[model samples]
Target: MSVVRAGGDGRTEADGTGRAGLRTLLRAADGVRIDVAYRPGPGGREGRGGPDVIVVAHGFTGDLDRPHIRRIAAGFARRAAVVTFTFRGHGRSGGRSTVGDREVLDLAAAVAWARSLGHRRVATVGFSMGGSVVLRHAALHGGGDPDTDAGRTARTRTDAVVSVSGPARWFYRGTAPMRRVHWLVTRPAGRVVGRYGLRTRIHDKDWDPVPLSPVQAVPLIAPTPLLIVHGDRDPYFPLDHPRMLATAGAGAADLWLEQGMGHAEHATTDALVARIGEWLEKRG
Candidate 1:
């Protein structure tokens, strides 16, 4: 049974039966509505003490409804409560995609909501562009840093962060796939394709001051555990991306360079997702 209830702070709640989980609409700090879903851990329930929660952020053009996203959430639900959301411009969410920028607010709200549901520990697991957002979100809101804008409203710290197939820097066109992505993000014809073919609404402008890059942000996430996972054959970014992130993280991050992996959700196997869940459980 799915029922929607709108909250004052731009949150809309819903209750679904069994393992299907609860669904909601949360407002980003910037006013965009983010569509979210929450699945309880094994034997877990809301308003009761339960397993730690994992906020799963999807990649570019992917949403909560995507099969891989659902599969990943299901895998995590075995060990932890799972919260999955559609970033702005994707799926049922409102507003345009800023790619990785401004999506931090969406994540912050989701994290906040997860904590509000009475989960004591909240970890983040992000894929691709979402991976970069997880890194920056941890830096801005998880490390107890006072300088970041996200810190003002974030009531709970992100206990752990896992970045899968994320880029270390922004504006990268080093690879053919990346070059094509840049074209899709910048050109009018490409925007049309993104709108119809990909179902992603691309933002028109370029970065101004430029948001903090993943490598740059990873340093500030120290004291908070972090895991950086990348595929050896990732078409969007090479091994250098994870290496740069691991280097910036110094001793605080764990790097996993999968030998046979290719990229993002499509390439991630069920066994790999279960392993990631176990990793979160050990740290939780």
Candidate 2:
């Protein structure tokens, strides 16, 4: 069953926009309890919605309540209602982090929850690891999002999708940061650090029969308004990643290689965030 709470602290709290926030513990198709947060925009109704709603997916090791994630949500709230959530195995969510594998189910639960809240023009924006999730989710459920709840279909489709600093292919260890990330998700000792130091519980199993890569999923996102944004100075997956994605998109997606930008949410600037909001607004 889905559990809905008005605020993070049990009492509804304003999102600094004079609008109260809604928190929820949603059940994924796999029965994972995913923690989600939503902040309505100006003139936006609590359960109903404004002109648009953007689902912001945080990167690995990040959660809905992080300061950076909050900042992005606040920026997006300027143009549309914003929804953010913690993937399984992160923050207050249940289950182990499959990194990017089964995390698609986590995102599906969040999108379904947002629709249940009454939003119609819903979009998805992801950072780094989240970037991958949005792409795959849109490809899999863009038409009529397949609700993974065993037997329920929640109409969790996305109107637009944005992937910021996402990797094109899997198992890429070209950069030092990526190498460290590989260790964090691969090694048992690293999993210990991920659990204790990063507060991220990663699954011990590997991707049995590897899932679809970001580039492979890009083509399927056609007609869904795909936007791929990456930093020129990203320390993680480099420029080649986005380039590969753009190639895979084959003119179906928009590519933005921001100058001097780095990887994911930490490197995203307020100006860029505003620009992203503008992009979403334009679509609506």
Task: Assess every candidate by TM-score.
Answer: 0.89, 0.91
Scored against the true structure, residue 145 in model 1 reaches a CA lDDT of 28
Tell me the tens digit of each residue's lDDT in model 2 across 1-284. Answer: 13345554443556444567777688888998888888887663445422367899999999987999998888888777888999998989999999898899888888777777777678899999999999998888867543344333336668899999999999999999989999999999999999999889999999988999899999998888888999999999889899999999899888999999988999999999988877776665
Give me candidate 1's TM-score against the actual structure. 0.89
lDDT of each: 0.85, 0.85
Please provide, for model 1 over 1-284, each residue's C-alpha lDDT reduced to its tens digit, 9 standing for 90 to 100: 45445454343433343444567788888889998888877663444332388899999999998999988987887777889999999878999999999999899989888977877678899999999999999898864422333545445468889999999999899999999999999999999999999989988988777999999999999888899999999999999999999999888899999998999999898999987876766664
Superposed by TM-score, candidate 1 places the C-alpha of residue 60 at a distance from the truth, in angstroms, of: 0.3
Pairs in clash, predicted candidate 1 = none
Once fitted onto the true fold, the runs of candidate 1 whose alpha carbons sit more than 4 angstroms away are 1-20, 44-51, 144-156
Which runs of model 2 end up more than 4 angstroms from their true locations? Answer: 1-11, 44-51, 145-154
Best by TM-score: 2
